[model samples]
Target: MTFTYQMTVEDAVSFQKELIHHTEEHERRRKVWMKYMRAILIGIGYVGTLFFPYRPESTALHILTAVTVGFLFALLLTPLLNDLYAPYMLRLNRRFLQKSQTWPKETTLQFYETHVEVHSVSTNIHRTTQVPWASIKKVNEDETYRFLYYEEDEALIIPKARQGISEAEQLEIDQTLEKYLSTSPNV
Candidate 1:
């Protein structure tokens, strides 16, 4: 089975955001302290807000209020800041971080019994890569995309929209992945 689709910078940014969100969720799940800390911070902020106008003379309460406000600001602003920064980061990655100047505009994925072949085409170049089933570290899906993670941070992003793929093709791709990936030790 084969699938081809266009990939834009927006797709890259969306993938990055999703990856970051997933990583954050995983960390939040793995680190029990982080969950407790967030709860404690919220509690402090709520309590401090209630007491802030009532008892201005309490030095410890004042300190707690200041700390809580600062922490809350940081927590709230981090995601907003990341949203603003992601596009620039993606641009920088395309221009300097990548080995090739020509980014993949159109990608073709050919799924075989044992491996998958990726063909990426840009204005200046055409590149082909083969990834064995054993090398695929993970397979992830969201509402808009299917991610085949070959490395820890790298993935072949496949859009789930009705671009060119039919339902039958999608099902076939899913079955092929499950067939190979289930047998592979890495995935």
Candidate 2:
């Protein structure tokens, strides 16, 4: 079977966001620590607000307040900033790291018995990659896309809205992926 779709910077950023969400869900200890840290920062902020006009004798409190506020600002703002900056960062990474300036290009995937071939083409670049079925570490899907993850942080994004991907085709792809991935020890 074959499927083709547009791959854009927006798709890359969305994948990054999805990866972050997935990581957060799986990292329970990290989430717990972040929650505790947020609580500590908020408590410090409250204490600092209560003693805003610190006397000369309260030099330590003034310093603590300054430190706590800085941490609080970073803790609260980092995710927001990341969301805002991710698109630009992905674009830059594509241009410099991947050395591809043209994106939002057509990507085609062809599934064979033993491997999947991916072809991506733009004005200045044309590339094809063949991934053996055994090399796929995982197959995951959300509402809008199917992710064929070959590594922890990398995947082949197959958008469900692509023209050739009908419901039956999706089911076939899912079955094919399941058949291959279920046999792989890494998954």
lDDT of 2 by residue, 1-187 (tens): 8877788876665676556555534256345545665666666665665566654457687666667675776578546544544355445555553455677778888889898889999887898988887888776666777777777777777776656568888788777777777643222
- The backbone clash count of each candidate, in order, is 0, 0
Residue 34 in candidate 2 has what lDDT?
55
TM-score, each model? 0.58, 0.61
lDDT of each: 0.68, 0.68
Residue 97 shift from truth in candidate 1, angstroms: 11
Q: List the residue pairs that clash in candidate 2.
A: none
TM-score of model 1 relative to the true fold? 0.58
Worst 10-residue stretch by lDDT in candidate 2? 81-90
> Where in model 2 is the C-alpha error above 4 Å?
23-100, 183-187
The per-residue C-alpha lDDT of model 2 at residue 168 equals 84
